[model samples]
Target: MAVSLGVFSGMRFVAAQPHSGNLLRSVTMAVHVPRKGLGKPGRLLVTSATVSETPSSPKVRGIMKPRKISTEMQAICGVDEISRTQALKQIWAYIKENNLQDPENKKIIICDEKLKKIFAERDQVGMLEIAGLISPHFLK
Candidate 1:
């Protein structure tokens, strides 16, 4: 049987059981090439040794600290201090709670009375533009 692992950290792993001598071997290969407009380049690391142990769980990275929400946003989000992610989550929850999604086009959010104040009195706004629209409601 042949087993192939998907890409991880830009590397691929392939394990095959060969009929010759009934041998099993695993091969890991990767190539690192920097691309224009991409982030920093990374080095290629390869190891031939095989261990029967499973890989360790990836570390959980810390998120950005909560920031003070502007007075206008605080009223909308019902929180004085909130992270950008949290604020967005609250806004999404509010929209869902009120069923603000357009019946015809789900991509559009119909601004309610409360949302109208935060959305600059716009009757309708695109879902993708929510982040940009709420940006001004966050304090630096």
Candidate 2:
């Protein structure tokens, strides 16, 4: 049996198993890497049989946007200009080094006076919510 993806003209076929009446249907699609200017037309084929070898993606290029840390938070979490990802890494490291994670539930982090002030008086908060609260302290 052949299955077609309604969105695109892609088709996939499933082979029958021995002594099995049912015909398993599978759908596989091929990716097309279009050639750039001055390049020959690219070929397309199903990728269900094997993985394609692709070069590593180029590094992202952009300005290092400056993030401002709140005056109070700056005193606690020392950092220069940092992206959101880097800020999270440093915060998590600080929490772990000081054993601030809740013993019963690691998702819940116990805050000291420093964190409490940054977190707006919450004794304990979930890890996900920390991102929102801390983001305000970072100014782009």
Candidate 3:
């Protein structure tokens, strides 16, 4: 079996086990060090290693779960309750259906009659701003 590990500082280490009856036998290891000078190439060094257990997966903390959409958003999305992801998907569907994207710059969404009400009467809005604009319609 082979295992690999990497560090953010651009160092990579790999360990491989050979087919042998003894588990504590010498293992093959390689270390890759990045070049320091500009346009220079890196180097790989091979060595031997001892036996050890594999590292476990890191634990993820403080993940925020999806919440239900607000009443106004629900009305706009035509659903009683929906996730934020689903709300965005529905809004994109509506935009595509109405050809609301600006022909000159696709990032700009040209608001139509129905979208004007949701977009605060703006004739055009950036695609990235759509989330912030619709944030007020969502429930806390």
Candidate 4:
């Protein structure tokens, strides 16, 4: 193995290229020095500096994945399908626009006529209850 060291942009880089005795199968790897407050002490990051592998698109799973929504959810999100994160964003936008949050306790939501439709006609709901209350609106 052959090793080389160099510095770029105030960061030190160490390259190691494996030497083959018979066949030519050399792969160069770079040793990455940890940045300030990145990782624990005495830790190093390594990567293939010479390789340029195209990254595959990330999979959409969990709450980020869009799914079919009920009519009541559609009414608030303005879309027939949406991700939980996006749905929450739309609901928060509606709440902020209409000033539905209680003035005395900001965490308390005073459901108006529009929110009541989705909140199962509940007169008021807590901030934490929003996620649970809206879950049914997302069709399985």
Number of the top-ranking candidate, with lDDT as the measure: 4
Question: Top TM-score: which candidate number?
Answer: 4
Better of 2 and 4 by lDDT: 4
Indicate the residue-level lDDT of 95 in model 3. 95
Quality of model 3 by C-alpha lDDT: 0.68
**Mind giving the per-residue lDDT tens digits that candidate 4 earns over 32-135?**
67777877878866654563333457789999999999887888889899999999999999999999999999999999977998888999999899998888
Candidate 2: tens digits of C-alpha lDDT, residues 6-102: 3343333333222334333323444433345634565544455422333346554332344667776765668656666666777788889889999
Give per-model TM-scores: 0.54, 0.52, 0.49, 0.64
Model 2 clashing residue pairs (backbone): none
Best-to-worst order by TM-score is: 4, 1, 2, 3
C-alpha lDDT of all candidate models, in order: 0.71, 0.65, 0.68, 0.80
lDDT (10s digit) by residue, model 1, range 1-140: 55666655645565655455533443333434334456465643454435233335655333345777777777778889887788889999999988999999999999988888778889999998888888777677
Candidate 2 residue runs with Cα over 4 Å from true position: 1-64
Off by over 4 Å in 4: 1-54
For candidate 4, list the clashing residue pairs, or say none: none
For residue 55, model 3's alpha carbon misses the true position, in angstroms, by 20
For model 3, where is the 10-residue window of minimal lDDT? 58-67
